[model samples]
Target: MRYTITGGAGFIGSHLAKALVSKGHSVDVIDNLSTGSMSNLDDIKNKISFHKTDILDADSLEGIIQNTDGIFHHAALTSVPESFTRQQEYENVNVNGTENIFKIAKKLHVKVVFASSSSVYGDTKTIPTKESHKLDPINPYGITKLNAEQLATKYLQFFDVVGLRYYNVYGDTMPGAGVISKFYYCIQNNMPLEIDGDGKQLRDFVYIDDVVNATISSMEKNTGSCFINVGSGVATSILELANLFLKYSGSASKIIFKQQDKGNVMTSQADILFAKQLLGWKPQTTLEDWIKNLYKS
Candidate 1:
């Protein structure tokens, strides 16, 4: 099978690309290298066709994405704090770029498994939010992701689309280097680990391997058109995560508290029964296990 992955040079996309290549599938990577690094694809560079093009370029995207079995759409501006100042840019890249992919996929009659975010739930009243939870994003980035999901719903009549509402997806090479990576960086550099707000906020940090597996399953399995939450379904507090990092790394680095960014949610936990029911996928990595292993060396 042949596949196309937008933003394939980034963290999650790069991992997916490598996985596909390992399975002896032909892969094509499309990335502008704006936030993604070429080094991420260095090992598999020659194995796949790499296109240095943005998703907004329909002509280029359509040309490369044609004849593909499926598309894993991961291209977007994904910074929450940054989205506030650059709302229009977020809308352009996340919403408009997504629509472009849907339009092209519609033309080609291909399936798209795109990245959505857990932020769409905002600070919901429900704990362990379900797919049926109300979507009321408090930030521009979440708003754009919600818009993209809506687009996916609208395009379902034409082709198959699965939008995975990813929670805090973290790994060794996560793009934008999420909280776990940031903590590791501080530990390595002997710097203080900074926590916004009271460090009591809870989050569901899903490992990249599990996320990649779930993503691939979504495309391979006939899940139809739906949005599912991809996460560990376990909620860990920020302070607990910090302590775990300190314990594993043996770092004496102090954890500092700072003001929380605007639109930051207090807690996020995924009710992933839908994912298991639809794709037969469930997260295998725990935050504690990954952190302990990372510093075990």
Candidate 2:
């Protein structure tokens, strides 16, 4: 199969691209290098098609969709605070870029698997957010992702579409240096770990491999018009995560508590039972185990 992965050089996208190549499938990648990096594809530079283009450009979508079998739309402005600063940019990339993908997919009849985010749940009181739970995003990033999910669902009637509501995915993926990467960097430098508020706010940190597997399952199943949460279904507080990192890295860094940001959600965890039932996907890496592996000396 020939696959087109938007943001292919990005953290999750790069991993997914490599997985497809290992499975004997041809891959064409489109990335603008905004938050993505080509270095992530250094190992397979010559094995896949690479394009430095943004999805917002009119020709970007049409050019890639013409000859692709499936699309993994991983392109987006993902920073929560960044979205607040650049609302229009976020809208263009996340919302408009998504529309472009769907439009092109409709024209070419290609299957799509979109990367949604847990931020769509916002500050809702729900302990473990489910797909059926009410969505109330407090930030522009989450709003854009929710809109993208809706558009994907609308596009599903015309073509195969699956929206993955990814939880707090973290790992040492080169292009996707998320919060986990920040933690690692801080620990490695012996910098004080900054804890927002009491540091008791919970988050579901799903490993990159688990997310990749769930995405592949969604693609292979051709799951249409469904929003699935890809996560470990366990919540670990920020302070707890820092301690785990410290233990894993054998670092002697002290922790500092900071006031929580006004709009930040206090807690977030996912209900991944649906993913397990639908795609036979459940996160295999435990929190402590993942931290240890990442920080193994």
- Maximum-TM-score candidate: 1
lDDT of 2: 0.86
Per-residue alpha-carbon lDDT of model 1 for 1-297, expressed as tens digits?
Answer: 999999999889999999999989999999999999889999999999999999888888878888899999998889998999999989999999999999988998999999999999999778889999999999999999999999898999999999999999898677544788788889999999999999989999999889999999999999889999999999999999999999988999999999987788998999999999998888888889998899776
At residue 140, candidate 2 shows an lDDT of 90
Measured on C-alpha atoms, candidate 1 has an lDDT of 0.92
Clashing pairs in 1: none
lDDT of 2 by residue, 158-181 (tens): 998888999888766643235567
lDDT of each: 0.92, 0.86
Clashes of each: 0, 0
- Could you tell me which 10 consecutive residues in candidate 2 have the lowest summed lDDT? 171-180
Per-candidate TM equals 0.98, 0.96
